[model samples]
Target: MSAIRFEIKLHSCNDRFNNPAVRSPLVVEVDLSGPRLANDLFFVLHDDTTGRTRLSSRLTGLGLAAAVLGELMLIGRVTVELTDGWVGLALVDAAPTGDTLTQTALDHIIAEPSHRFRIWLQFLARTAYTDVAARMTADGLLHPPRGRLSRRRAPVLANTAAWPGGRLNLAIQRRQPLNLQDGVLLGLLVATSGGQLVLWDQNPTYLSASTAALPAPLQELIAQTEAAVADSVISRR
Candidate 1:
């Protein structure tokens, strides 16, 4: 199967983020066409090597829910409304998403358009992590570890799950222009405060710009995710 490729060209700019080499219309071709956005986000958040995330389940679940919302928005099934300081969501298309999880989410949004974004995030976070993990297991991206030791040895697990993180890490390190999916990946990382794990040891310049490149809806989603997680942390303290 031929993988889909995206070519992103960076025009000359005076921003401190762009290195000299990338200033002259640099073109970057990247193949970020693996799993869908939500699946890829779950794999990146779950530590395949350790079978756990460094962050709390609360944060990871919120991030996963946000990612799924992002996927829905990308396919025109949903939209985030940011009017003034208020943020909420609405269903764009009543057509079935062809996936149960997202379809259910859309249904909820359709049923009650008044619920704020944070409310939906908290509600979905209740199950997004486990649900996505189960989906990945069914799709062959993860193998249910049989025991403590099987965490590392499970077939079709770690390597596949780790690929998304490694791929995004390399993109930041190499200062490549990120596609929409990759941009969202990085944004979600920073949103979940997991940037230090993957964005660590890279040039902060282009990496910052890459995330800032996300479209309006996505940028709003990440911003809301960050705020929601912050509130959770504060309440815990």
Candidate 2:
């Protein structure tokens, strides 16, 4: 089948003046595409001053927690996009650290059902901003102590990795049928596999709702793959 694609954008905020009081923001982008497998992205955010690192994963709660922390820490903004068989997430310039809160949230998400993608994304954006604002206040970055700010309506398109020469090992297990909107959740797990995009179909051989309901082009690609695999097996014997 036509290879699926995914992309990621990252932003970071750091103390530029070597003082916790002065923070500078940084932004980055990444893209990945290939066969649907497992563990496609790996993300890390570090607080240089405290030597704290937030290892990111696609666990629903973890993403939200990071977003929340970003808000609290005065981290800028993060944007994620999924389109035409590609998925990507973007962040301003904030260090992401894996902490108890993030881990706990991720665990909770995993235990939940597949219908929570939109909720998770909404939560991520809201919490991250809120956490950043709160953190700024706690760190004396902001005055008057403002509450969580609402996000503007961003574009949501109709929707949509892996690499070698790397040392880290990643495993992605597709335990259930994830709908189009929720597919972006995989991007979170991408952070664990050195930023490699991995998708595991619990029923890899079976057609996904997205696949069964695919456009003609994708359908043709799947047909070609099936034929090719059959040809290979026959020739081997």
Candidate 3:
């Protein structure tokens, strides 16, 4: 239910970058190595048919937040700890994440004295959509409508079927082993929304098998986040 609140917070944001929009124009920074976790989630969550996102901003936000956290976990930038019977985040190495969005998530966790996962999830989820979308747009992976008339519309990507998300979904569906980064990506996607939004004809059994391939700690984290996402979606339905 608290997870549902996280989704609601993300959906309620009408202007994703208003607070940070006035800063400057976007500059392209293609990783070439691969899409960042947030960018991959954006590509996966986008709706090709509608030129909008398939998942609500909330779900997308939570997914992105989870992705950011997962990325950090993979890089040894952060880790979770049990405190007073609650799982909270702990800083591992304060080194820069290179990517701004991931750094922001790290900064948020570091700045706040409290480390509750849900609290950080809610904050990052609410903010990640705009940051990730802007990065994708800058990278030429997505095309956001221009002009004041389309200002309120959500961003969309073209030829999404050819994007990295397609490969990720294929890997999951085929139950193929993924490298650490992809494994984290798949686990985060599955955890946040059961990969329903990302994959067509989602098979629960297949998802379970794919998830089971993750490292034990990552598996537990994803499973917890997945339960929260499920509760949020079910409540809305």
Candidate 4:
């Protein structure tokens, strides 16, 4: 059987933070192909202080859906890939060293047994620490919590039952053009995933004090979408 090889790439771009000015955006790429291959990736970004996430993404295939769903039910962990061939996974924490990619980091991510989605989310959370620092230099008021460090052990799905509570109420405005059902789905995902989710509300007055500190452009974008959705709902009535 052939091995399912995984490769990762990280890119950085200059932002506002830095003495002479040195910052960059980080991008990650993952690849996998093999017999009976299941490729599922999940990314999560959390604010250290609130233990809440600003964003999350999931990628996966069909065969493993049962396992993934099972894991989510029991522990929120899913099996990302299972091939008769050799399997490989990679993790790259790009922020700390700047322009550095290490094989050891990749080796660690591959060795984990948790679903690919969880691994990706963990990687994003870890890397965000450095990314946020760089972001702060450009906008001091745009502060989010730093990412947390996982213990050096095998990765596992987080237990939603034991997760912390969320202070922010996710209000999906109808104006964003998102279907009411779809908006509800997003809310359900976040609620079930535990308290790490926050809905993007366009009303500045509605935003939490913490999020309100972000740049005006970002604030407007968040609100405009929500407002659009809200208006849509009103029109139907």
User: Best by TM-score, which number?
Assistant: 1
For candidate 1, the clash count comes to 0
Kindly indicate the candidate among 1 and 3 with the higher lDDT: 1
Worst 10 residues of 1 by lDDT: 5-14
Per-model C-alpha lDDT, please?
A: 0.71, 0.30, 0.62, 0.27
Best by lDDT: 1
Question: Between candidates 1 and 4, which one is better according to lDDT?
Answer: 1
Give the poorly placed runs of model 4, Cα more than 4 Å off. Answer: 1-117, 140-237
Worst 10 residues of 3 by lDDT: 2-11
Residue-level lDDT of model 2, residues 24-83, one tens digit each, is 222222221331111111112222122122332223223434333222122122232233
Q: Candidate 3's C-alpha lDDT?
A: 0.62
- Residue-by-residue lDDT tens digits, candidate 4, 1-237: 322221222122212122122122212121212101011111122333333434321211111221122212111112223223222122232222111222223333446544343333335334433433333323332234334553111113243211211112323343332221222223223322322343344344423433333222222222332333344346657
Q: Write the per-residue lDDT of candidate 3 for residues 1-237, one digit (tens) a residue.
A: 111000000111222213233222222122336556666666666664444666777777887878778777766666655556666776767888777777877888888847677777777777777777777677776667667665223435456524657787677667677765566677777776636656764767766666666544455457657766877789889
* Order of candidate numbers by lDDT, starting with the best: 1, 3, 2, 4
Two-way TM-score contest, 3 vs 4, winner: 3
